[model samples]
Target: MEVMQKCCVLFKPDTESKEMSGDSLLEVQRAKRAANLRESLFQILSGLYGIMIVILGAVIPITEIFMSEEIDSTFEGFYIYLYSVSILFLVYVYAYLLRRNRLKTELLTRTLSRSLSSSRAWAKGLARPDTDTKSKFRKRMISLDVSNHHTGTFYLRLGVLGFGIGSMIHSGLNFGSFVSVSGGDCSEPVQWVKPLIHLMFTFFQLYFIFMNSKMCIHRYKKLARFGLVHMCSTNICVWFRSIVVETLHVIHHSDTRGHHGAESGHHPASDNSTHARSYPHSAVGHGISHHGSPGPEYVIHDEGMEKTLVDNMSHVHHISRKLLAASVNASGNISSASKDNCHWKNMMSQAVEEAGPYLYPCTIEYSLMCAGILYIMWTNVGKRPRRPTRSELETDSEDDGVEDEQRAQRMSVDCTSSSRGLFLGILLMVGTIISIIAFYMLVNQEEMQDSAIFLTHMSGTFIYTVTLLALLLAAARMKNLSFHNQQEANLEDILILISYTGLLVFIIFSLIASILAETSTMSTLTILSNVSMLLQATVQTIFMLAGDRMFAATEKQVRKKPGREFITFLLISNFAMWAINTFQTQTPQHNPIQVDFYGPEAWAIFTHISVPLGIYYRFHSTVCFSNIWKNAWKKRKHA
Candidate 1:
């Protein structure tokens, strides 16, 4: 077993220098675990801070109104401004660190993956019949495992606990004095409410701080064990010395130095004259060549020189390894059998030269982004989509070996059948227009003007009637067959169209009521109508971006780029509208005229709820648009 172990170690050259003993190997493992722990803590802290900042920003106006009595106007404004600015600064710092770490981690992963391929090839040529050799042959091994197993679970647990604790604590504080509350007024209740709000803030903030500090200390302890300082060193001496030298250097440097540097780089006028007088053949194969292009002989000479240098390097590497092996064998541990294995020795040496260091806390950016996208889809769409049936799976499994031929056939079939029924397309067009109109009326009009009111209802009904007629004509055209050979609408498309039509019909009715009604009750209904419109638009936009697999199958398709750009632009515009509307709601000009005992008023509630959803939707849309732009740029470059 000892002889086998020695032979195995001899064959695996990459591990020898970095990990010479069991103790050092254990120490490396400890450092890796510590790094991973720090990374995980960092992500969790970042997420928590982001969530808190967003929540605080959304509720600050309402919170201020609630605390009007205790907080003086000047201090309140400054307080809100200061906190908002601080939060924003922290978010910016986190983002910078995230980007830097992401790049570093990706570079490390790429290098490690490349080295893994080389290492596996080296392991394959060992030519040993022992169990250790067979173990290495059975599977390719990497220098490092690119997984952070407990990281996700840690984040999940922390999130659940934090939210649960926060909710419970808030409820406990509020439940005791629930009935006496009258919307941020009354002296006795106001006193407790102010303290209660402050207490809740303090509790949550302190909890976050404690958790963050604990993690930081733990990280530092682990790092100390490995004698590794933080990547951004905070050493006072280093900073002091750097500042002193930089200050002196800046003072000492003169404008003449740059002029002198440029002068030295430029050739003299005499040299230029000399060169101008020389013939092209004057320095042929010698000194400074007068010709702009190298001759065939010169090119051949350069190639020969490069080949000789490479050969010498290889020879030197081989000789050094042989000498090292001889010294190791003289210690009487390395066997004669290992000495005879020249092929394995050479392979191991090459692997050692190429092998990358172990990488811990691998890049989880792609995985996390994919998970976020999945979660958004799952939440919005609701429930897992049905899996493919056995027959469908089997049909897809059948491969006739030529994928291009199969794809062409599929494309032809899609082209032939991909047309939407005329009725459905017309219905969708009218519904989209009506929904947009209704959303505009609800958002823009506090009190409906007669001209706008008359126009809104008239426009909706007229368009719907015209769209129906257009659909009938389109259906007639489809019956002629030749005009509609391209892609027709599928059942899913028809269902989406029908749903949109139904929503538009409801919105049209709500618009009529919103115009006719005198009471404030209809304000709630108006808000609901606007919500429905936004949701419909959001769902359709998401489907348009992600629905068709074929659209994304070839990003280089010229036709697809314009469609993607249009969708991205549309989503961004809609996001902007939501953002602006949400901001407008917070201003004095847009504040609700009537505040009921239940809440800050229907309009206020709508804005507050929409703001958070809008922020999340805007972020998602921004990510989508960024991806679309990147894809378009890539396609354009290739074209």
Candidate 2:
């Protein structure tokens, strides 16, 4: 009887080992299949990236040169080319997304049918010995575990991007109207098409992103990778194009301002003599000459008209000699200008040009937002979902329960705890706004320009210094808090580090220029601002690193956390800095010291490239700080 019991136990051990071996074999097969898919996906992605780089490398410079050469001769055809290509790319992506969604629906329907059939078979007891294995294999083939993890960018950022796209559409329509009415060499069909297509693309693309920004693609992995990567590359190209166009516009404006200044300086007496006489004729001539080639037959030889043209030569110098002659003739017939009326066209052109500076930043920001979202999507393609362990599942449920309890209790923000920081932040914001207003108002005046630039640097220096000190104090207070390191770095952390490099580049360049240039008020201010920004960025990064590791403290220990107020203050301050950088600092006039030191072309390129990233850092930092503030004081769960 004892031998018989022993034999039964030995048989039980053998059966258990067999079952474990089968499961291990299945897992190994699944891993091998995933590895194979990953290898193929990578190869395809590398090929796509290589192709895009080659195409952009060959196309951008050629298009730029063509546009530069044609600028004086004709209205911009570059915009037409740009919008047409963007429209094509957007249309392709739109189609793919729709088709992919449809296919996924069909696949899901088929999977449900199979699952139902198998359930019925089991209910009837018609299932075979291997039925479970076959069903599991089929499920793996038909469905994937999908994850929708937060990518750190908040909906507020998306709102900002939408605002920017709307601004761009408005600007584009104004530009299209100006071109269409001016009756220049710009094609009639193309004039309206650019803005209309831009409007359509933005509407659809924004909708798609809002819907699917967090979706991780698990099926059709190859096609998903290609489409996502294409979208990312296209957005990056758009960003690059925006920066180039903005830089060129700034340089052109500076040249115009410099020429106007030179003329005003050299002939202060002539301005009084011809102020009234030349005003009307020059305005008429500018309107006519800006549109198209006015024929020589339109020239009239009136003495007053000729004098008006000569007095305003600096403004009309870019116009061809034929156009100059035509403008002289048009000025004589200014009273009878009904035949070639341009009043409406002139007003629209002026409005469009005036709005460009404000609207350009929006488009730049939009491109960057799209690029970041698309890049995240690209990385998420084919990402396998991780299965949580039993312990993790329990922890998550407990946390959710805690959150529900807090919500039921009607928990509210602890404003009293952060009152000092909030008040100080408000004051700093008010002072920064005042400085920005003063700088903008005085920047164009020749005598006040230097002082305006100095004021800008000084205000920036003060903000950076204050923020740096606050961050340091917060770090010191939080140094002893209990926390744990993340097992792996996430995409948000990687992106923040990458964005910080952009600001670092700008700071290093500024420091080098300041050190190299002769000592002056502006240079001294630059050095101070650069040092403060560098230190602020470093300390802020450390704070973010520390914040991520921090475990929520108990209510009793919450008072010791100490950085919530500082975090609130830093958030508002960073936002204030973002606004200042976007609207004021990016302008070439505001950075005369860098322009003078690096020369116009080099400086323009440097700022256009780095400033956008710096702006993004400030904007992104606000989001990060807001997250820290929200999570820093949550109640810790005790084991």
Best by lDDT: 2
Q: What are the runs in model 2 whose C-alpha is more than 4 Å off?
A: 1-63, 66-150, 155-167, 170-179, 255-344, 387-405, 408-410, 553-555, 558-561, 635-639
Candidate 1: tens digits of C-alpha lDDT, residues 1-639: 999999898978866665578778899999999977876665455445444543543354333333322332322332333323433433442344233333334323322333433333323332234787456423321111112111111222233234334333432332233223333221233333432443343243233222221111121222222111110111111122212222222211222243255479742332422122112121222222211132223222254565675466444333322222221110111122223422223333333222200000000111122223222211221121223333222222212123566647744543333233223434444554554455456646666533343443344344334333432342332231122123344322332343344334434433443443334533443444344454544454434233321222233342323243233333344344334333332322322222211122232333322332333333334434333333321211110
Model 1, stretches more than 4 Å misplaced?
1-20, 38-448, 457-539, 545-600, 611-639
Question: Which one wins on TM-score?
Answer: 2
lDDT assessment of candidate 2 = 0.58
**Residue 482 alpha-carbon offset, candidate 2, angstroms:** 3.4
lDDT to native, each model: 0.32, 0.58
TM-score (C-alpha, index-matched) for candidate 1: 0.29
lDDT of 2 by residue, 1-639 (tens): 999999999999899999999999999999999988886868476557736753773365335433332343232354444445545644754565445344344323322333434333432332242678556534331222222333433433454455557545554644454344544333345435545655565565565565456555654666666666665665555566556555644544555564566568842334434343222222122212211222122343466886767646543333322121111110111111121333335454455556655565556666667766667767766664454333222222212223444644423335766777888898998998999899989987889988898888889988998999999888776666667564355445665676688889888877877776667777788899889889988888778766855655555546444777788899889978987887787786876556555656567778877877777778778867765675565544332
Q: Which ten residues in a row have the lowest lDDT in candidate 2?
A: 327-336
What is candidate 2's CA lDDT for residue 578?
Answer: 83
Candidate 1, run of 10 with poorest lDDT: 356-365
What TM-score, computed on C-alpha atoms, does each candidate reach?
Answer: 0.29, 0.68
